[model samples]
Target chain A: MTAGATDKAGISWLPGRQAGLALLLAPALVYYFVVLFLPQLEIATASLMAADGRFPVDTNFRRFVTDPFFLSILWRTVRLSVISTLLAVIVAYPIAIYLSQPWRRWRAVVAFAVITPIMISAVARSYGWVIILGPAGLLNQAITGLHLGTDPQHLLYTETGLVIALTHLHLPFMVLPITAALQQIDPSILRASRILGAGSMRTFWRVTLPLTLPGITAGATIVFCLNGSSFVTPALIGGARIPMMSFLIYQQGLDVRDWNFASAVAIVLLLSTSTIVIAHLIWSGRRQRRAAGAA
Target chain B: MSLPLTSQVFLEVEDLALSYGKSAFGLAGASFSARKGEVIALLGPSGCGKTTLLNLIAGFLVPDHGSIRVAGRSLRGVPPHRRDMAMVFQNYALFPHLSVEKNVAFGLEAHQVPRQEREPRIADALAMVGLSDSRTRYPRQLSGGQQQRVALARAMVVRPSILLLDEPLSNLDTLLRKSMREEIRQILDRTGITAVLVTHDQEEALVVADRILLMSNGKIEQIGTPEEIYERPRTEFGARFMAVENIMAGSVCSGDTAGTTVNTAIGQFKCTPCDVVTGANIKIAVRPERMHIVAATSGSQSYENRVTGRVVRSTYHGTYRRLLIAVHGMELIVHAPVSSDDSEYSGDVQLTWRPADTHVLLQ
Candidate 1:
């Protein structure tokens, strides 16, 4: 009798709770529908139209795939996005580890310094990077100062410069998630690893790194997706010589007045990012299943 | 200190101290020694430096002063990994990514144990913890008791000089806590490894430890066998922590070879004296369980201390009845065993106890 009463009581409150949750989520749902889904749906429909405006056509996609100019732009976009994302991971780990230490006297200051840069406009940060990556910039001066007898390298308008700028721009995205993960690690687990006779480096390898894999994956996805669709940093840093998929979409849509082709390029970029993210999710999920299944 | 004479002292901490800011000692010159196969429990309330002392021993926290030695070698500059110690954490600290067998094998791999010998050892450790059948399962898949067992297996497989347990049973429910504490005690007995268990649960300490180091405010209040610590606590903190509810402030009425009768608002009560003289202002305490209801028991002994009081309230505990008696403007607690006639009695009742049960406090 009490069980039936409790079941009814449990069932009764759920709809009200769900309604309240839906009410709370109403704004985000509406915003995503209007600001995100509608534009993407419009782009998808436009991307399928031929130049003569016929429905269900693939001429724009065919042009993008066959044209080497657009193809190189696609490859460059993926290559730069992957490299910058990898670099962000490598850079974010040490910074995240430093920020995760609650005992450090200047930890709050360091965390502020790492995170507050995101508040600055992306264009302003790109300009700051332009100063550093210029021929007479801080990076070139430091490189030549090492006395390798090399001239000032032209990094201001190159793919390498674009990668450096993107890495800097997306650092906070990577570091914030990784820092949260690092801090979430139980301190006693690290101590347990140490007391079990693993040194600091070994503990990091065997314990800390594996535990923060989810955070790294999340950060990498965000950085890679952002870099894939990036417009400003590439335009300012790489210039016209190193055009990305986003740059092609911008140039074709507005300057060249090819809406169908531009929408196709946009859809391609979206699909590529989604494909990579989904494939990675599947791989990690399988790995977790294998881990759970292994003796 | 209670170990057999044949066993050598395996772990020694001397004057180990760490101070926060400038003045407050995190651990104020704390020192204790454990024999080769004895279990020592650091029993205390929270924020009393029990965990700080455990961390110092594990080499997780460095001491500001003094030294720790294992097998007669000073561990002044040694890192935690090189200290030859293992800690079973309160949260179990199992590697979430690793399965049971691999988690057990982690320490061996870190120590570079031979590839051929690892499997058998892991299997044996699992069997010891009764987790051999669940070797493929991750820690999150296991129950809390199972996780604790895995933690024990992982710690014991390393065969360190000293095994440390930091409130390993606090996370378990009461029923599981009881069984696990007994299991832990059994495992330690079988392994005969020197262990330092840090716990706030005095009952857990009494059940699992050979000797209890009662601590308060960064210092060892008293250290003795569980029997000695419980029956004859040296400090008020020790008595209170051990559940002595009737701690009262009194002065020595008179003293001789027999016992000391203290004067308090409750009344003069004769008790076994310790380090006191007449007319000295001091505090005294007694365990409530030692005070028996005179009428409840058929024929009460001629208890040296007797008080007639009105039973203000009576609470029925499963094992015994707790009665609050108002005696001479002061409340005293008496525990009455539920005899065949378990009827509630709430009136004037005589409570009695012998002098030896009343523990006269030294400080």
Candidate 2:
């Protein structure tokens, strides 16, 4: 008799839960449908149109695949994205580790300094980078002062300058995630490792690094995706000499009025970012499953 | 593996003091010594600095003053890995990422012990804890009690000069705690490794410790064998901590060589003098089990200390009946074992005990 009552009691809260979930998620669902899904559907339909504006045609995609200009632009986009992500990871890991230290009481200040670029408008920050990387800017001044370059070095409007600027712009997004992951590690585990006969460096490699891999993966994926789609930094700094995919898309749609081709390139960029993110999620999920099985 | 008889102390913690922030004395001026094969339990209440002392011994926390020495060599500057002592934390700090065998072998690997010897040592330690069948299991796969045994085996596999346990059973439930306490005791006793355990559970300490150091407020209250501590507590804290209840204020009324009669609210009682002169203020302590309850209307018997009182309340505990008697404006608790028919008299009961049942407190 009590079992029957308990079964009914357990099932009684389903309606309330449904109501609560709808109340909480309605706004986000509406916004996603209107802003993200509608635009994505429109882009998918427009990517199939030809230059003559016929429906269900593959000319836009054919032109993109055959043209060496678009192919080189896509390749440069991926290369720059990979390089920037690597640079961010290498430069930010140490800073994140230092920020995650228990005795680092000024961690908030350091974190604010690392993320300050994100608070400024991306255009303004990229303009600032343009000033620093230009021939008459900070780099050339330092080089001339050290007598390494004559008069001024043409450091600006180059791939190197673009990568340096992108790395600086996306460094905080990388560090924030990694630092959060590093902070979740219990201090007692490290102490226990030391007591179990591991030195500090060994403990860091064996315990701390493995536990923070998820954070590293998240930060890398974010930085890569953002740097891959970046427009303002490369367009303003590299000028006409360098043609990143986003800058090319802007030129195709706005300047040349080739909306179909621009939409196709946009879809390709979205697919690439999605593919990388999905692969990462699957890899981490499998790793988690293996850890659970081992445990 | 035999050393000389006078090879000096195995581990000594001297005058150590520590604090977190401005909180005074997590541990203060604490000192103790352990020989090669003894178990000393640092028994105390929570926040009384027992875990801090263990952390200091494990080299996890550096003391603000004094020194820690192992084998007469000062270890004040030595790091935790170099201290060569294994610690079993309260939460059973087993590496969740490693299997039980791997956890046991970690110390050996860190010390660069030969790969051939490592497997055998790990296997032997696992078997010692009766966990050979579960050697491949991770800590998350095992029950809490089993995980603790794995932690024990891991600590023992290292064969350090000293082993430290910081409230290792506090996390377990009551029945598991009792069984695991026995398992821990057997393991420590079989190895005969010098060990120090910190626990707030007095019962756990009494059951497992060869010698119990009772502490309170950053100082050692008393230190003795469990039996000595229970029967002859030196301080009020020790007396109360050991659960010797039944305190009453009394002054000497009649004096003799063997015993003295003291006038108290519960009437005149004969007690052994606890270093007190006649006619001095004294506190008398008697365990609840020592007092017997009789009907207040019963025929007078020749009991040395008998007080007539009404039974205010009675509780039927399974083993015995605990009665609260109102005598001379104070409650006297008397425990009556259920077996004896003479112990069944309930309301308005006359409590009685002989001179030796009462332990007189001078201070």
Candidate 3:
């Protein structure tokens, strides 16, 4: 008889092993069902009902779609989010590359600097932006001190100022994922490309960028979502002059006490973000497939 | 830029040296050359500077002192991509995202071989490596051996001036390593491409290289044909690295044109004539397999060197029986054909070897 043949199966209470796996997953399953899905189900059903309990529950939806003010707010929110998301991705790529090199002595310091803003409360951080983006703030002072301008830069309560703040807030989210992807790439792969007669620039374009696309996709999705849903930065920096979807949802639900209209607006925001995110996922997924298939 | 097709000297490295810190040196004054289409193996154990030499030639590293030349032109400031040399990495380093076809086409595209000229060359390279059917498969989808073939194809497709293989077969299973070493040698021979291979395995160097550069302690121990390096290693380091079993310290007692005689702690021995002065301390090596355990009565016969010793232990190795015999003050290993009966090995046995088999190692 062989040695292994005489040994009994392990873990007596978990005979099949499948049951043990299910038991291990019980906590997360219960939490998601109780704390996430059930409340979302109620809000989804309630979003279709009118406030007065009247027939033709499409009352809030029609009012929201026909209003110019609400539509403009929606447009401004999407515009600012997209512009900021793009800005964050553009600025984060180089920083991600730098952070991924383990041999750099200052890597830890740079990483801490990148993620420091995220640790502070968003309200406090938005207030900091408010100070700098004021009419005669540090930015304008620097602009004049450089002897480049005496012009009145309307950064305070402007769309550009809000975008700058959002990009700063979400920059870490963008850098971390791309850094992970860059670290995953084998260094020899880069060396191989060089040995094959491609210079550094061509190697980056042909090998580094394509291999790190998944990281870029993940970062973009996260930054876009965070920017779209954020209320504090916009409310403080943009103020009443530049209203956004989040502020509108807040004003409608609490101050005006129009719960149905608020719910309808929330639903619209959720749907818009989901549609864009899904489109992006599909595009990236198909691109990955094409990369594999073309070989 | 013409190489004269008659295969002139293609690569030359003169006194190459590199160091990491004050106490640690990576390579020290290594110098060698390869004729056009000649395959040279840089053979050494780990930390012995073989890979450093390969990198210096490939331009991934620049020597702290010395010059590397291709076709007699200095490569002091040339970049790797501009050197027209391609490398096959040990891990295969196939482009993970690209298919087999695209991986093979990468070099052609980088060199801009022209779209019309690319397809035929890619096909030829793939066929050369026997991977034409797996063109559409991604690197992740293929086995390790297949990926290695793709790597070979990718390097070959570039038609590089020099092919650098950095321990290319070190990652393969033993069975595959045995097969791939022979295949790589055949490919190099068939194409007549100038190549340099770095390996820690001596057998690999013997099988795949026209010449072997043995290294030790960040310096070269010897460079010669495989048989020369194995059968007549000039240094003790080379002998040990080549798995020489019997290395005994001795003093040269006398010298003549016929042979040099050395006296050791156990007894006196005769070896091939050397240029060393008589009465100098030296070391001599003999292979275990070269020694013979003759019958006890044959001790009286005419043999160049003869000794009788008591058997300490005997091991059965299927085809051969290894007798570990205790001489006067030292032990010697002798390999003899397995006798009909294993019981007789416990008695004292007489050993014999020719004078030519005794090798004097130079310091």
- Highest DockQ scorer: 3
**Which candidate number has the best TM-score?**
3
Model 2 agreement with the true structure over B130-192: per-residue lDDT tens digits? 999997777778888888899888888989888888899999999999998988888888888
- Candidate RMSDs in Å, in order, are 3.7, 4.3, 3.8
Please estimate how well model 2 matches the true structure, expressed as its whole-model Cα lDDT: 0.83
> Residue A130 error for model 3, in Å?
1.3
Q: Is the docking of candidate 3 incorrect, acceptable, medium or high quality?
A: medium
TM-score, candidate 1, is 0.89
Clash number for every model? 0, 0, 0
The predicted structure with the larger TM-score, 2 or 3, is: 3
Considering DockQ, which of the candidate structures 1 and 2 is the better prediction for this target? Answer: 1
TM-score of 2: 0.87
- Quantify all predictions' global Cα lDDT against the true fold: 0.88, 0.83, 0.89
Model 3 lDDT per residue over A212-263, tens place: 9999999999999999999999999987799888988888888998777887
In TM-score terms, candidate 3 sits at: 0.93
Taking the candidates in order, what DockQ does each have?
0.64, 0.55, 0.65
lDDT of 1 by residue, B57-96 (tens): 9888899998999999999989999988899999999998
Candidate 3: the clashing residue pairs are none
True-contact fraction per candidate equals: 0.79, 0.46, 0.70
Give the alpha carbon lDDT tens digit for every residue of A244-292 in model 1.
Answer: 8888888899999999999999999999888998998888777767766
Model 2 pairs whose backbones collide: none
